[model samples]
Target: MTMSVTPKKAIRVVVWGENRHEQINEVVRGIYPDGMHATIAGGITELLGDDVTVTTRVLDDPEHGMTEELLAETDVLLWWGHTAHEEVTDEVVDRIQKHVLEGMGIIVLHSGHHSKIFRRLMGTTCSLRWRNDGSDRELVWTVSPRHPIAEGVPQPLIIPGQEMYGELFDIPDPDELIFISSFTGGEVFRSGITYRRGYGKVFYFSPGDEVYPVYHHPGVQRVIANGVKWAYSERERESYLVTPMYLPGGFDRPVLGSPDGLVDYYTRELIEPRENAG
Candidate 1:
C-alpha cells in the first residue's frame, strides 16, 4: 500500500547523525560544513517539501536528542552513525527499540548497520567486509524496481568515489530487497533493503560514507527522501503486544474455575502456579 502524508498532516522525520566526523576531521567538515544530519534533513525537505517536516539531531545532544516526547511525535527517523556507536547508551537503544516496535519508522544509513538499534532489530552481528580505499566506485543497481523506495531512482546509480563495502554482510534476510551495489573491485553487497519489526518499518541504505561526498549526490538524496516517505506508516499508532490483551478481539469468554490453574494468554490451556513463587 502506498503511504501518503497529506500537507495538512506532514510526515514527521528526524535525521540523526553522529556529528563526530565533521567535528574532528577537516575533510568531513569541508564536505558537510553544517554537519551531515543537516544536509540529510535538507535533502528530505527539498524533495518531500511540505509533505514532510524534517528535523536534525546528533549524538552529542542530551539523550542523543531522542527524548520520549520527540520520538512519540516522529513518524520516520533516519539514522547515520559511525565511530561512536558504543557511546549511544543502552537506555536510548531501549527507547528507540520500543518506539520502533510501536510503529515509528526508521532508516539505518551507511555504517549504521552496526548500531545497537539495528543489531537488536536484526538479531545479528551486522558485520561486513569493508575497505577505506577512498577511490572505489559504487554502482547502486535497483533490484526491486517496482518498490516504492525505487520510484524515481535509475537503473544504476553511479557513485564515483566511495568506501568499499563487500558482501557477506551479517544480517537477517530482509523482507524486501530494494537495491544491490557493486564496488569497483567486483564485490557486490545488498545495499538497500527493508524489514517490518512489530508495527514499524525499516530501511537500510549503504551509500553515504563520511569520507566521500556521497550524500551530496542527487540520486542518493532522492533515495533517502523516497525512503522517508516509504517508511511512514499510514495507520494510526497502535500498541504492540502487551499485557491485558484479551482473546477474540478483546471478547469476553466464560471463565471456568480450576483447582489450582488459570488459562494461558496464548494457548488458552490451564497452567498451575509454581511452588517457588515469591
Candidate 2:
C-alpha cells in the first residue's frame, strides 16, 4: 500500500515592524503592547490558522531580523515602519531586494511605502500627502470586490479613527487597485494596491498607522491576513538568476552544436537559404 504525501509545506510569513513608536510613545505602546509586529503576526495566524506559520521580526534585531537564512525561509514578509526608515542599512535593503526578485512575496503596510525596499522595487519616490491629528475617520472602499485580498473584506472598511493618508500617491500604476479610501476631511487615497517584480508579488495596504489602534481593527486585520494569503508564491523556482531558454531554430538560425566543433547542418527543408544565396 502507498501512502499519499502532502503536496506543499505550510505558508511561511515574517511580520517586520520598526517597533520604535511602541518603545518611545506611551500611547502607541498602549495600543499595541506586544509591539505591532507581534500584533500583525497574531492577526495573520488567527485568520489563516493551521495553514500558515507566522513569525515576528523587528528593527532592533541583528541585521534588522532579516538574516539571509531568515529571508530564504520566509515565503511572505510584511513590513511596517514609521520613524526609522533611514536607519535601515543599505546592505539589508539590497538583501531584501535580491530575495524579492527571487520570488518571495512582500506586503508593505501603511508607512512602509516610504521604506527603502518598497521604494527600490517601485523605482519611484513612493511619496504621498498625509495628515494625522488622530481624529480622522477612514472608510476603505473595496474597489475590486472580486479580488482575493477583498474576499471577506467589508464594502467600506470603517475605522472610527485613523491617520489620514491622502493622494497624489507618487508611484507607478498598480497591476491591481484593490481598495480606495476616503477620510472625513474629504481626502481620498489609493489604500490598497498590488504589483509584480521579477518572480515576486507585492501588496501595499495603507491603514496600520502606528499612532492609532488601526492594527487592532478586525476589518483591518482581516484585510492584512487576506493580503498575506494572496501574496504567497506558488512557483517551483526561487532563485533570482534566470538563464536563457533554448527553442526550435528556423531561417538562418541553426540549432546549437558543440561550440568547439562549430558544426553546421544545412538543408532547404529545415532552414531556407538566404534569398541572396548564389
Candidate 3:
C-alpha cells in the first residue's frame, strides 16, 4: 500500500508588516533596524533554507506590496500589522480574502488579529485583553505537542519580555489549538491556533510585539517558521473553488461552461451513485 508521491517545489513566502513602528519609534527601529517583516522573513529563510523562498513586504509599499500578481505567486503570506490595520484598504483585504479562499495559506502574527483580513475571515471582532507597558514574561506552552507546528519547538518556550494577550479572544474556536501562552499577570491566552477556510489554511500566532525584542528570540522565530511551513498548501492554485458538473457515467472530465451562461451550468451530486442502490 506504499505509494510514491512527487515532491513539490520550495514554498514561497511573503512577510507583510505595517512598518510604521520601525519608521516612527526609535526603540522599535533600534530593535529591528530593517523592519520586523525583514526579520521575520530572515528567520524563515534561516530555518527553512533552500526549502523556502522568503520575501518581505510592508504596508507603505504600493498597494501595500500585495499586488494580485505578487499574491498569485506567493504560497504562504505572513501578516503583521498594528497601528495601520485600519489604513489597509478594503480592496486589498478583499483581494487577500479571495486568494486565501483559493488555497493561499496565511499566517497572522501578533496584532494582526485586528487586521481587516483576519476580521473578514473570522466574521467576528477578533478582540482580546492586552497590556503593552512592557515587563511581561510569556511562557508559551505546547498544548498540542504532536502537532507539526510544535515540532522541534521547546515544551515551554520562554519569552522574557512581551505584550500580554489574554483571553476573551473574540473569535470562533480553532480547528487546531497548538500553543497556549501564560503571561506574568496570571492570564492565559490561546497563543497559537489554526483554522481552515475553503481550500486555504490559516494560523494565528500572538507573540511578537513592536516594543519588545520578541522576534529576536530564537524559539519564537522557530515557531513562526514552523507555522509558515505548516500553513503552506500543496494543492494547485485556483482562483476560487467551483462546482463543475460531470455527465452521467463521466467522472474524469467536468462539464465546463462559460461564465456568462447560467442555464447550461448544472449542479450534480458530488458523490457518485452506487450501482447496487435502488
Model 2 over residues 1-278: C-alpha lDDT tens digits? 99998876789999999999998899889999999998999889998898799999899999999999999999999999988999999999999988889889999999999999999999999999999897899999999999999988888899998889999999999999999999989999999999999889999999988878888888999999899888898774355554322335645544323323322342213222344232
Write the candidate numbers in order of decreasing lDDT: 3, 1, 2
Worst 10 residues of 3 by lDDT: 261-270
Q: Against the unseen true structure, what C-alpha lDDT does each candidate score?
A: 0.89, 0.87, 0.90
**Candidate 1 lDDT:** 0.89
Better of 1 and 3 by TM-score: 3
List model 1 lDDT by residue over 210-238, tens digit each.
Answer: 97988999899999999998889987666
Segments of candidate 1 deviating more than 4 angstroms:
1-7, 247-278
- Please give each candidate's TM-score: 0.87, 0.87, 0.88
Q: Write down the TM-score for model 1.
A: 0.87
Residue 221, candidate 2: alpha-carbon lDDT: 93
User: Which digits, one per residue and each the tens of the lDDT, describe model 3 over residues 1-278?
Assistant: 99999876899999999999999899999999999998888888999999999888899899999999999999999999999899999999999999999999999999999999999999999999999787899999999999999999998999989999999999999999999999889999999999999889999999999988888889999999899889898887764557776666878666444433322224433333344222
